[model samples]
Target: MIGIIGGSGVYRAEMLEDCKKEEIATPYGRVSLTVGSFDGKKIAFIARHGEKHSVPPHMVNYRAHIKAFEILGVERVIATAAVGSLRDDYVPGNIVVPDQFIDFTKKREYTFYDREAVHISMADPFCDEMRAISFKVLKDFEHKEKGTYVCIEGPRFSTRAESRMFKSFGDIIGMTLVPECQLARELGMCYLCLAMVTDYDVYGEKPVSNVDVKRVMAENIERIQRVIEQMLKELPEGRSCRCSRALEEAR
Candidate 1:
């Protein structure tokens, strides 16, 4: 089964058929899951910030969430993230499929290899196959095929200086996707995130604000939903990458 993790303003996939809510318990903690079928294929959905958008980036139980997906026999994950644009090319209301990522997260649980020192390769963090499929599905839109995403540890927005400095590091900025992306790799599950630019952080001429962030996300969510549904429908089945064998050597 394929799994979908919803970010800000994307609580559930209203387009799914026969969807139901269920409770799941993991080694890390318990979480709620929405399961159903999309285009005749089984899919499991999870709200990254809870169903009500309550959890913050630093506090999210990424380990538990990934663990739950594993237990449910999920093979690949399609994650949605609301991010800030750090470049002019990636403007607000654009949907980006980041093929590279840099971690700026200050505090958060990073891995599940607590019993041993496991160093999984960070090269090409997102699934290449998934990223390719995403671009094809969203080709007509203002889509960026590949870009660098800097994941910050935040419930707070970045300062002007901080945001400006990050412009050198990545094309887009987001609070989630750090442990979330790395954790999926450790579990050998294919993972890819669709980064939706909600605003131009502090790098833009206009100052960043929560109200503006919400407004941009709200406006572009429907388009994102369309892309996601098409992605789920058109994604090719079976293995095409090393994502499934991520722990082959590390273990």
Candidate 2:
């Protein structure tokens, strides 16, 4: 099975066939998601932010969503996030499949093993196979094959000074992806983030706005959907990446 975790501007799984709304009970809370199929692969999708974009990034229930996918037997996950570009060249309307991430988030659960010591490796945070497949499928699009994501704790955009600091080492900036990505690794689930650039961060001397982010994402939503669809059709059934073995050495 496959999973799609939709972030800002992505509220539904319109590509899934025979879709049905499902609500699952998890240790954290109940999670609402849609279940369907495409290309014979069962898909489960949940909006990272609530459907109406009411849930702020810092307040997202990262655990319950991952737990819901686990309960539904989802193996690989493709998540979408709208981000601000840290560099001038990584312009809006482009897609970046991040190979690394720097977690700057605070006050969120970073792991599921709070009761025990389980240190999972995040050296290469994303699933390599999924990254490779995404690169291939998005070849024709204006996409970056690799980049570093800086996930911040936010209900607000960054200050100019803060944006400049992040620009020193990150390619893109967003409010989600930390605990969500790491938690998936703890459960040995293959995860990938398809980050879409919405605007220039304040480091570029242009202030970020919710209006601009929504506009960019709204224009390119179809492109994102097509990329996921192609990936679903190309994804193999066997497990070959280290993602499924993520917890083998974690103790």
Candidate 3:
């Protein structure tokens, strides 16, 4: 089954007919999930920010969410995130399927391999197979197919100086994505992050603020919802990539 992870508004479980909620327990913690059929295909949908958007980015249980999908037999996961733009090329209201990620998250549990030493290769953080499929579905829109996302540890927005420093390293800025991306790979699941630019961080004339981020998210989430719906309908029956074998050589 294909898994879709996003905010409550972006990935609606009510959109599915005969929907049912299921909770799974992982070694890390518990993950609440909803499973139903969309377009006659079985799909597992979960909110990245908890059911009511109560969890902050830094407090999210990345391990539990990804592990729940793995235990439930999901082959691939498509995640939608609201991020801040660090580059002039990517502006608010634009969508981007991040091809790479830079982990700057300081105080979050980043791996499931605490007991064992597993050196996993992260040459490409996001799944190439899913990225290709996302491009096809969002071709009509002005979206970026490739960009580097810098993940920060935050319940707070970035300062002007910190934001400026990150501009040199990445194309976008966000508070999540680190452990979520890595954990999926460790479990041999195909993961893709579909990011929506929500603000210009501190790079813009006005320093980034929660108000602006929420405003931009409100404007662009519907568009993301439509794009994701179409992508789910067009996914191939089999994935032809190395995402599923990520643990083969590493373990």
Name the candidate that leads on TM-score.
Answer: 2
Candidate 3 has an lDDT of 0.85
What TM-scores do the predictions have? 0.97, 0.99, 0.96
Point out the higher-scoring one by TM-score: 1 or 2: 2
Task: Single out the weakest 10-residue window by summed lDDT for candidate 1.
Answer: 201-210
lDDT of 1 by residue, 61-118 (tens): 9999999999999989999999999998888888999989888888788899989978
Candidate 2 lDDT: 0.93
Per-residue error (Å), model 1, residue 237: 2.5
lDDT, residue 227, model 3? 85
Which 10 residues in a row give candidate 3 its minimum summed lDDT? 7-16
- For 1-251, candidate 3 gives per-residue lDDT tens digits of 88888852464644566789998998889888898888878889989887778888888888889889988899999888888999998988889889888888898887888888787889988888888888899988879998899999987888888998999989998888888889889988899888889889887988888888778887777688788788888888888989888887886
Which pairs of residues collide in model 1?
none
Model 2, span 20-138: residue lDDT tens: 99999999999989999999999999999988988999889999999999999999999999999998899999999999999899899888999989899999999999999998999
TM-score of 2: 0.99
